[model samples]
Target: MPTSYVKRILDAQIYDLVVRTPIDEAPQLSLRLGNRVLLKREDLQPIFSFKLRGAYNKMLSLGKAELAKGVIAASAGNHAQGLAMAAQKIGAKATIVMPTTTPQIKVNAVKALGAKVILQGDSYDEASDYAQRLVIEKEMTYIHPFDDPEVIAGQGTIAMEILQQVPERLDAVFIAVGGGGLCAGMAAYIKTVRPEIKVIAVEAEDSACLDAAMKAGRRVRLKNVGIFADGTAVAQIGKETFRILKDTVDEVITVSVDEICASIKDTFDDTRSICEPAGALGLAGLKKYVGRTGAKEQTLLAVECGANINFDRLRYISERTEIGEKREAILAVTIPEEPGSFKAFCASLNKRNITEFNYRMGGASQAHIFVGVQVVSDDDRYNLVADLGDKGYPVVDMTDNEIAKLHIRHMVGGRAKEATDEMIFTFEFPERPGALMKFLTRLGDRWNISMFHYRNHGSADGKVLAGLQIPRKDRKKAHVFLDDLEYSWAEETENPAYQFFLS
Candidate 1:
């Protein structure tokens, strides 16, 4: 009677092609929120995304003559790979035009799948323009990534799978929306099959086209889309997908980039699977909603749609993960400029260890020290702040401050110079009992410490700064032994201050 029934049939026909991706119960998430949580692992698809399900289905539905003409599509990454792989399997010629800035890994993958890869402009819109021109010039059938009914129908299969996998009727399902294809398809089918179930579409706050369109009661184009989550960075929603999503989707919510990063880390900790920022959008939305609405009893499902992360980007993800989760705090502490003053500040740290400490001369009386501390929980951060307050120390919490996180951490240590052969090394060490003593014992009397500084600034671990004076003749040998020190040390010998002061 409804389009959901048709969706179910289509899903059945493509069941062999589509992976029966796991709908694992997220016990950690469930216990933390006191709610039942299910994670739909569409990220495990053969193409590393659920886009393959829709792309393949769309190509398979094409008429014989249409297939002969071949297909052209535009995408930044995931969809391009999906369409290319789908077209290859169906023996249809496919041309995938992607932005020039698209990751090389994705470009090579599409080419490996026997698709003609075209590098176009800097963004998806420019690539799409080039793709449309090719479609007209080559007389190829242009496959709309999200707007077409057939494509939407294919994406709708995910909803059918979700219903089949989860035993209980979900109170709400969070779908990450980009051009509205996934959300439109899932919402159209889910609302038809289970009218009482809420369909929430999640989008990055920086690029929330559906949210803007819904507010205006029509399609709205965003001036700029955030590139943090490349998979879901759409400036505009498709015409057909918008039509379906407008009525079917219960709510469209936006989340910050930090929230998405936090969820990605959470997913890794829970499942050991690294989801890209876009893939973690559904989980971010679920967490936001649960925190805001306090819907602890609601049965919630989060669709993890893809896991195509660039290997290099993991460093940035890892760096921001703790701050995103509020587990790490960066603080700027002002302490009196005196020899014993450093020890007094360390004593004030109480039980907290110093993760990082950098001291720079602010004035004659006080030193501006940047410190990093690890907190057991979010509430522990408040406790640390209160402790600092009681100690009469001026502390500025830069935990969520973006500029401080990036520029301040490395520049906190004071300016100093050592001899030409001396090397300034920075080390991060655990702040346990006898750790500092062990470090001092290891250095011994062989290396003259030109500049030695250490501060325990309320972090879980401590950071040490040392300038080792090595003879010009022994520089190479000293470097070799330092490498074997087996500590997190970086050579700052090339730094300008080392040239001017140490040299």
Candidate 2:
């Protein structure tokens, strides 16, 4: 089975539309990480993603009649563009059923490539179901984004190119996994050809289907999938992809959204090219690997897979990069509400550059301060907190608090005295037209909204933090309503950020 992939990879005739992507060195990252960091620049593909390789290969494998019958697929973004381009090149019709939550740039790209774009459902699974119906009705050939042998072999070409390009000894090849096609294809080829090399599969923490499947020894669907890295936001791993990957991959590394953001910044610093969150996923895992294992001077490569990010999302990504790199510490410190207390707290900081500072008088005796300070490392952050504690100031480290970073930081105001029995909740919903209205409508007039904050991060999902006035007697009812809402919601009533700044 493994040797079959080697032949399929060799026979993959993708050079017609795919290029031999370059493997460039990341000088600054290499120096900082103390490892020879190399980037497989698959972002430079004709469609700005390696998805084209698999798409074109699968199309080319079809008979003349099949090609003439047209092809259909469900994709978040990259695969749609790849399939559209492939169909255009081969003079066949293509229909791409994409989630309504997909970025406008991707939708426009598919249309520009002469593909019929149909906006469906809020997630890939929903769109995929819609695509299957269309496939039957239109009698078109369904081109799966992953799972097919031709598609897997096509992605394996990247592994083939890596072996040929990097003649030097390599420690590992890091690949990002969605449905597992990319990792399975690459891992099968690499393991069979070079057994000594490690094939590392990187996944976003919110959407690690392959990791879940491997642990269970069977594929299991995730209850909820995060779309921050929309390209890799798959709920379940493909049967074919999981079979190949379970045997070939050496390790699986899952990364946070902030870590992915930091890698995007890392890629931009070295190559002067912006990578989407999923594109930079492999590099994020590579950095974590080096930091944890203390691997040094060894050659490691990460696939920089795509650059199809929305320009507006850069600000949100940039804001979180500092925290991801462990260079910023966000804390909630309590001090006496007296004349000299503020000055004393500042002096205790030892003139460190303060990134953010928020103060509000909570009572006659105490004041809560929400602050962000520049830190060199995680140790430095702890030392700063310890020093503040020694100076008679109570501190709560909020650097890793999702609610604090996303919403509480922006809404750091003293609590409203009238807002009694307030329950805080964070919800994630598809960022489509009338989405907010629909969410509010679901709640109806049952609970009064005391505090609310929403910010669009230019991704598929919209994050909202809301405080509602719900009495203890109606708590069970409120939870029942939330559970039936079908949105990813978390009760943040006990969040320290809310208690320190708002309550």
lDDT of 2: 0.93
Candidate 2 per-residue lDDT, tens place, 180-260, comes to 889989999999999899999999999999999989999999998999999999999999999899999999999999999
On TM-score, the leading prediction is 2
Report backbone clashes per prediction.
Answer: 5, 0
The worst-scoring run of ten residues by lDDT in candidate 1 lies at: 494-503
Q: Model 1, residue 44: what's the lDDT?
A: 91
**Prediction 1 global C-alpha lDDT:** 0.78
Model number with the top lDDT = 2
TM-score: model 2 vs. ground truth: 0.98
Assess each prediction's global lDDT (C-alpha) against the native. Answer: 0.78, 0.93
Give the range where candidate 2 is weakest over 10 consecutive residues by summed lDDT: 353-362
TM-score of each: 0.78, 0.98
